[model samples]
Target: MNINNAYVIAKKEFGFNIKNHWFLLSSVIFCFLNFIIIYFGEIISGDYSQTDIRSLSLSIIHLQMYLIPLFSFILSYDAILSERESGVLDLILSYRVTLLEVMFGKLLGNCIVFTISFLLGFLPVFLYLYFLGIKFLVLFKFVLVSIWLSFIFNSFALYVSNSSKDRTFVILLSIFIWLFFIFVYDIIFTFFVVLFYGSISNYFLNFLLFFNPAEMFRLISIFYFIPNDITDLFGINVSSFNNFYVCLSMFIWVVFVFFSFLFFYFEKK
Candidate 1:
């Protein structure tokens, strides 16, 4: 594991993403959405005399649940397979770097791109919230959770990228996985709860929630930031587990999928 080789590859990948406009495009989209959210929040506050920080944060969380997964998938779905198909993987492997180092470098590069875009997009909103007298702690927590959510999905997408040699198949699979996790999972959970009702234990439901990063993120935000009424409105029973458990579960999900990606990636090599 030549750390210097890895760093060089990571820097190159990160620079390529910026030069190719993916970073700029994502930042612009997210910034526009963040501005709109703040504008709407301002309008609501005008009528209500108060807008809770939690409300704004929850709104962002819900949007993040949908957008982050899609963006992550689109950004990384071709990270590895495209390299292989274009013979870039072979060229890179001829260098001083090991396969593991290359994988780690690519992962790091994507992470850097994502983190920069997220900060650029959300910094203005954070400032606006601060001007509105929202506490720093709440805003900071939201940023942390949002970043972790992106990381989780990016790892999943990279796994998809590494798994398939077919770019078209990888693209389709990425979209399907995003749709399943972001939309279908919630619908299925709701259906089961509605149908079975008391037959399903709350623990079992929370267990299911823990498995889907998107739902887990929503539940975490609901418990941490949003009011109880919102959960009640959706018939969601807030889990008894602490935020630490949810964070750990998400971290574990990222690590598990990432290593699985690395294992398959090297196996093919």
Candidate 2:
């Protein structure tokens, strides 16, 4: 893999995506939508005064987890697949560059775009909070988690792009996976837990909860929102345990997904 070739490819992708008006427009629209939703919800619920800055920050973080994944899917789900479908993959492969270079360059390029769009969308919210005299550390933590969430989703999208040959199938599959991660998995997990009731052990239930990314995100958000001891009936520090386990699981998933992509790419090649 030539570093020069990878850089060239990365530059081309970055330029092409940055100059695309539709992408820019859509990002702006979505940012506005997020602000509107948050602002209006605060008004209608009449909870703005009651809400702590940390809680508001968590709300923004939760929204980013939902939005960034969709944005990443859009940016990357078709990256390699579209190139392959358009008959450019063969031409690219004909070059002296290795497949791994091509994949890494493409992934890096898409990640750059993902990061830019996410920060652009999130900046206004951060600014608003700052003007409202919110703590800087809270905002910084939200930004950190937002970036990690983007990486997780972008890696998944890259894996899908590399593995699939059909663009439509890639898009549909990405959407299905997104829905499953964000919503359906929790419902299914809860249903089974309810059905089993007391038959399920606490250890088993704890392990089961770690499987879904959304649940992990929620737990982390809860911890960030209410960091201190809010105890349960069992007198266990639920928030402390939730924070520790959720962060551990998220770290594991990031490593697992990244290696999974590399393995699939090498195997397919």
**Candidate that scores best on lDDT:** 1
* Model 2 residue 79 distance off true place after TM-score fit, in angstroms: 0.2
Candidate 1, residue 262: CA error in Å?
A: 4.3
In order, candidate lDDTs are 0.78, 0.70
List the pairs of residues colliding in candidate 2. none
lDDT of 1: 0.78
Model 2 agreement with the true structure over 91-206: per-residue lDDT tens digits:
99898776677767876777777667767766787788777786677667666666677777777787788766877778789999899988787678768766886776666766
RMSD to the true structure for each prediction, in A, is 2.6, 3.4
Candidate 1, residues 111-133: lDDT per residue as tens digits? 78988888887888778777777
